[model samples]
Target: MKRLLRAVPIAAAASLAMPAHAQFAKPEDAYKYRASVMFLQSQHMGRINGQLKSDKPDLALVAENAAILDVVNKLSFTAFPEGSDMLANSRAKPEVWSQAAKFKQYADRLNVDVGRLLAASKGGDLAATREAFQATAKVCKACHDDFRRD
Candidate 1:
């Protein structure tokens, strides 16, 4: 019957909409989240690079003045699910989800470094800000080198 047909499609869609994310039901979501965080972090860093590369004091001041901690501040405490199949084409190493503890440690270090950078920036100290920024990059790179596929 027509009623039965309608009910069947609705039921099928309902099943697909189920939100049973296995601690990590889709692996690619991890990659997506990582990409999101890194992209946001780099935006400001890119500005800093341009300012330093030009060696313009006024440029440096303008870059620092326009800077804010909010970008990195909003990125903490996020965790990716462990084994979602959505990660099929991702460059993230399975070890990242497999070794959650180490992954978390690296994330925490980034949070700390960003926090320090935020404070240093507020003081208008460009040198300290650059050091903290590099430290944050190191934390991210160190982990990626070991666990990322590419």
Candidate 2:
């Protein structure tokens, strides 16, 4: 009888601790994750833009180049899995969920562009890298135009 009572309260407490079907453990965690992704995006975009404007463009020379790639790789590998914090980001347009196919297309195109830029980065092939960077920028802009709000 005592064990049953203890178990009952434990179960009740556990149930109360978490909401049913809750995607994020905490709202702040969602915010943190979103901020992290935003930081990575800004860094990546800024480096490419600066590289484009430089007389001798080279992504490899950027301080955040390797770090950006590290985050980018992480972003690529971490599956949002529909209900992850990234999916809950307010900056993430509803179209990300509603039009997943098109979103994925943009994502794939961005991947190819990023890959090309990285591959061409080491040999001072700034022009070629800039072309890829420009394509990636277009992909970002296109998606934001269609999916994100100001």
Candidate 3:
């Protein structure tokens, strides 16, 4: 039972990454995959922001949204495979591929930032959570400014 409980979390984490491992059939598919994942991320962030703006900020809800953000965040970066920027629906700039290392740096930083946000929310510290949220948003904005087309 103890071993099974431990494996459950491991299995769950692996499943979340399953899509990232799959080869997208085409550039459009890759764009769609990343776009969908990013959409989910945006929606979750909006939900957390809404909770934060409420008179009675619900740290629990924030944490829930943060958790979802944490997972979707990891997934989106993986979908930005080569040549996906050519897709009509893609807003990704050439910099995403041209300045690959810098783009990856942003992706890695965003993951860490979101992790911090999750920790702050789970700790039930509203101020800390707000600070962490802002930090995460800054990373997102910086990445968008550099890699995404307007």
Which candidate has the top score in lDDT? 3
Which 10 successive residues of model 2 have the least lDDT summed? Answer: 1-10
How displaced is residue 20 in candidate 1, in Å?
17
* lDDT of candidate model 3 versus the reference: 0.79
Tens-digit lDDT track of model 3 for 31-87 = 788888888988998998899899999999999999999888888876766666776
Give lDDT: candidate 2, residue 87: 35
Give the alpha carbon lDDT tens digit for every residue of 1-150 in model 2.
222222223332233233232233544444465457656776767876886797876556642473465346335322222433243345556565557667667766766776776666655576776776677678778977986667
Per candidate, the number of residue pairs that clash is: 5, 0, 0
**Residue 75 Cα positional deviation in candidate 2, in Å, after optimal superposition:** 1.1
Give the lDDT of residue 13 in candidate 1. 26
Q: Compute the lDDT for candidate 2.
A: 0.56
Clashing residue pairs found in predicted model 3? none
Off by over 4 Å in 3: 1-22
Better of 2 and 3 by lDDT: 3
- Indicate whether candidate 2 or candidate 3 has the larger TM-score: 3
**Candidate order, lDDT descending:** 3, 2, 1
Runs in model 2 deviating more than 4 A are 1-24, 62-67, 70-89
Worst 10 residues of 3 by lDDT: 1-10
The clash number for model 3 is 0
